[model samples]
Target: MLRFLNCRCLLLAGLLLLAPTVQAARTILIFGDSLSAGYGIRQDAAWPALLAKRLHEKSLDYNVVNASISGETTSGGRARIDAALSRYSPQVVVLALGANDGLRGLPLAQLRDNLTAIVASAQSRKARVLLVGQRVPPNYGAYAIGFHDVFGAVARARKAALVDFLLDGVATQPKLFQADNLHPTAEAQPLLLDNVWRGLAPLLE
Candidate 1:
């Protein structure tokens, strides 16, 4: 009986020591569209998955929750933002929507408003936001330029950090992209992770 009690005491002590480390792990919410959803490749090859791996390798206390979906637009993200916040209760939110919005030539005003609302909602929940920007083809003309600029504008106005482009290094490399030329191949995932890391690192601190 005495030996049993002593074993129980040691187990309790070990659990007490581990309490803080367990509580230290927080959520990082990845909110985006197909670009982030690993559209043409394996899910594990996605940037968000790479982010989780990076966090683990660095021994950071964050877990990544990718709530991204294929064909998701800013309007869709806006409608679901609150639910995502409630579900993840994240410490940091990586906002990467608007690509589909640009592709569809959605009104910039609506895009701006939706993004603003999403950022505001996350901030209100005390989550730091890293807004990831997108760029469309030059063929889209002035609308493409406007779409690209809106992300930076929102980040500035909302006081959020910005990743100027998710495909910064990969975009210009056609061979790095999948056959569709819109999505990056698995090989390009790391570059995407690197792009997001620049803005996301400071928030982790």
Candidate 2:
């Protein structure tokens, strides 16, 4: 009986030792706009989901919680950031907003401040941030330059990682985008994931 009791205790100890590893999947919260939300594609086909798949392929213990909305703006993301950080307590926060603000011709100053706040909020929670930049059509005029510059400025000032531009190569290719020519299509998801992973992979380590 004593031998059986010892065996049971050993089993319990082993299980207890493994519990934290099982429950401690590091989370990466992707807070963005339609681009990350899958817009015209299936949710599972989105770059965020692809990121999860890549993580599993490499045996990384991480979870990606995509909190993106189709029309979300920098201000909107800033407003909800604290609640998201509190809820997920993510190890990394991917800030991919501000596109809507640019599209709507919102004030660039407001966009910059909102992004700064979002980055600060995530960092305050001990979460590493990746700020994904956006670019507007040339028709929007010189305002586009300032809009594009905000991501780098915020990243540098706040000491955050940056993807530079989420749509980089894909943006110039008309075939890669949806009919609206704004959001990326399923075919472009992999490239988008690659662009983000270039910056995000380091944070995971």
Candidate 2 C-alpha lDDT tens digits along 1-205: 0000000111110000111235546888889877777776777788888988888788888878888776777887889889988988989998988878887789989999999999999999999999988887777779988888988999999999988888878877878876665567899999999999999999997
TM-score attained by model 2? 0.87
lDDT of 1: 0.80
Best of the candidates, lDDT: 1
Full-model lDDT, candidate 2:
0.78
Candidate 1 per-residue lDDT, tens place, 1-205, comes to 0000000111110000111234446888888877777776777787888887788778888877788777777898899999989977989999998877877788999999999999999999999999999887778889989998999999999999999988887877877877765667899899989999999999996
Q: Please state the error at residue 94 of candidate 2 in Å.
A: 0.5
Poorest lDDT segment (10 consecutive residues) of candidate 1? 1-10
Per-candidate TM-scores read 0.87, 0.87
Worst 10 residues of 2 by lDDT: 1-10
